[model samples]
Target: MFHYTKLDIFCNDVKKFADADGYVPEAEDICQDFSYPDTQFKGLKNWTQHIQSSVHATRSAQQKLHAWQNRL
Candidate 1:
């Protein structure tokens, strides 16, 4: 798991973590437009929520299953 104190750091870390883990997100799960407004913090908050969503959970499980199968 990755963690960061700052939102920018967190976002960057997510990308790195995903790449390192070979996490290929589904089309609808892409957050390429994430932008944090100078006056608000909704972008990062939304991203945080997105990763916790059921769809993401399903995708993660599928990835794990694939990896486990490949190992067999």
Candidate 2:
């Protein structure tokens, strides 16, 4: 039996499920078996819109995302 006393959410196993977008590290350069969720909205842009309107995204998080976008 195992006893758990701490909540360590940053473990590697948890990271695997952290992907909300269809970001394949190697989208087309190689092979992949992973699948990203798709709804009425398709592609990353639409998915982002859904998150923004429904998730009540914080300003700081939005600014960070904006910075990331600018880098690209």
Candidate 3:
């Protein structure tokens, strides 16, 4: 499975989903390995649903928290 960090979340990019350590997985890998609960989508529809998900909001907040902490 591919691991990703908040920095990898790109709503407007074709090549999305990167590892926290900066490894960008291939599109095929992403399709085969990535799974979100109760949803099956592709393309812009997938991105749209993702940004609206609770998981996305939570992760985004966590990312912000980490950034704020680093600045301190």
Candidate 4:
């Protein structure tokens, strides 16, 4: 009999349940041999999101500032 572990279950489930083209590489798979939870990558995701949001916010503020300057 084969010894399929818990991780094998998650990978199979994630792959199966994931939507078409929504394939997410398992973080655990990347860190080692698929041995961590999805939350382990949360900080990286959060950092990227923060940078993107900050850039967007800065651009919007700059646009408003420029418009105000033009009016002055």
State how far residue 64 of model 1 sits from its true place (Å): 0.3
Candidate 4, residue 37: the lDDT equals: 49
Q: lDDT scores for all predictions? A: 0.42, 0.34, 0.42, 0.38
Model 2 misplaced stretches (Cα beyond 4 Å): 1-39, 57-72
TM-score of 3: 0.28
Candidate 4 wrong stretches, greater than 4 Å: 1-42
User: Per-residue alpha-carbon lDDT of model 1 for 1-72, expressed as tens digits?
Assistant: 322222232233334324223352333554553333334324767555645653454445556556766785
In lDDT terms, how accurate is model 1?
0.42
Span of 10 residues, lowest total lDDT, candidate 4: 1-10
Cα error, residue 25 of model 4, in Å, equals 27
Cα lDDT, model 3, residue 42 = 52
Candidate 1 residue spans exceeding 4 A from truth: 1-52
Best by TM-score: 4
Instruction: Quote the positional error of residue 3 for candidate 2 in Å.
Output: 29
Clashes of 2: 0
Summarize candidate 2's per-residue lDDT along 8-69 as a digit string, tens digits: 32122223322344222221221123344444445666545544532232333445556766
The candidates, ranked best first by lDDT, are 1, 3, 4, 2
Global lDDT of model 2: 0.34
Candidate that beats the other on TM-score, 2 or 4, i.e. the better one: 4
lDDT of 3 by residue, 1-72 (tens): 233343344322322433334333433334334444334445755644544453454455456657776885
